[model samples]
Target: MTDDLDTPVLDNHLHLDPRHGRGIDAVEDFVHLGGTHLLVVNKPSWHLGVEPDEPADFRPVFEETIDAVDAATEVLPGRAWPVLGVHPGLISRLVDERGFEPEAARDLMQGGLEVASEFVADGEALALKSGRPHYEVSDAVWDASNAVTRRAFELGAALDCAVQLHTEATEDLTDLAAVAEEVGLDPATVVKHYAEGRLAGVTPSVMSEKDRLERAAESGEPFLMETDFVDDPEKPGMVLGPKTVPRRVRWLVENGHDEAVRRAHVETPAAVYGIDTEATLE
Candidate 1:
């Protein structure tokens, strides 16, 4: 393939789970394919079905995520960043005492993310004492998560690294913006890929994407477009064919949407990942 993405070609979302072909093979492939850095996200212990009922027993997922990133950075030299978090897939658990009822969290086994709290303590606290888990957005939870995001952002700033996040629902994106702002993060600091499925209420490819794109444009926040994943045709999707970015870049050269596209796919991500915009995509 062409080194079109060689400019930075960073994939923020990747897994270490062997079942999804995520382990070393995945890392090797990404490096081979020109991924300068990968944000490796990890999960909590409960998902493996072996854990203490106590929140105190579980470690913050970020700890492991950081470890993974550190290891990758050492091994890859200039590739692999760690994205730390618990997915909101556990909305039920946090909001209801009946949270972990049989089959309640079973959905997590399949790419679920609602479990990890930005604040490991909060998620664990809720997990242990949440009398009535409510899936609806909780200010307390958001606040706690915001704090954790800030810590992570500050950590990134210290190392000049990018922070990967779980951006699912409209609320999730809202949280992302809030946390980014709270952490004094430039929109470009967030590296998101395949993070859509989080928003349950917002139907895919619906009216939200236009709003997202418009927001990205207005804020000069560059977002990403990944290929090979599902997209909601109703929205503006970033996933382009291997040729999509080039074609779109060519199209923009020959058409409009250049300013917006440049900000979203190029400027934003490049700035966040510390890549040179003029470095040449290939």
Candidate 2:
């Protein structure tokens, strides 16, 4: 096992579901592993077998995520930020299970994002989270998903907060950038979560892949690191463990790539998220 790095790393993305394992323990472990900060992305209600007939019904998921982030901050104060959104996958779930019409699903997603925008405006959240179009869905559904995601970008522009995007692998981001630009959001404000390979005009919050990390390092590109840790007791370490980002940073430092580690785990995330690394780690 790799030891933690001297410079604490920040996990740009992670999901700490209280319904699964111990949320507090997860936060403690992340902090102990030299993780200086993180963003908690909550699962949508459809995953929990709940179909929302009203926009207010989505409130619980957002509240739960906010509470989780608050709890994590209390455990490791100033290290947690809340990220809430209507995930793109939720649209498929709503249609497949709840029999929501395409337009209805789209409307619901738009409404949920409006609520997320409200959270940003009210200072309840630091940013909005949403995913781009899914390839598996039909063209109509894909169009709707893209439209909702565009709405998220619009909200982000108005609120001056970043938008964390969940997109498919090998996606062409030029169009997304154009969409955000059209909505008045700078391309840099769209963070591509679970990112693989380098992308232009958007910040790639990479999963903990050594080869990908090394490649990004070689280019000296600014990016963020994440474990994408889904704390599900059943699946255990689904994407990567809570300590993965710190260990990756330590590994990079040992391999004479400390500068890259610093850029990914410290510089990029702080700039994109508007966090003061010194104050956060203190």
lDDT of 1 by residue, 1-282 (tens): 334532444343444543222345445545554444444555434453334344333344444545555555554425554444444444435435545533333323211222333323242211110111124445654444444445554544444455554433343454455555565655345544443323221111111233343444444334553332112233224343222333333333344555755554446546655544334322
Worst 10 residues of 2 by lDDT: 1-10
lDDT scores in order: 0.40, 0.80
Clashes of each: 28, 0
Superposing every Cα of model 2 onto the true structure, what RMSD results?
1.9
- List the candidates' TM-scores in order: 0.47, 0.93
TM-score of model 2 (CA atoms) = 0.93
Show the lowest summed lDDT stretch of 10 residues, model 1. Answer: 124-133
| Residue clash pairs of candidate 2 | none
lDDT of 1 at 216: 41
Residue lDDT tens for model 2, 1-282:
223356756788888777766688887787776666778887666654557877777788888888888888887634688888888888887788789987888888989988888888998888889975545888778888888899899899999999999888853588889999999998887999888747776888888899878877887778888888877788785889887877778778889998887788668766787777656765
Listed per candidate, the RMSD to the true structure in angstroms reads 9.8, 1.9
Top of the candidates by TM-score? 2
- For residue 191, model 1's alpha carbon misses the true position, in angstroms, by 6.8
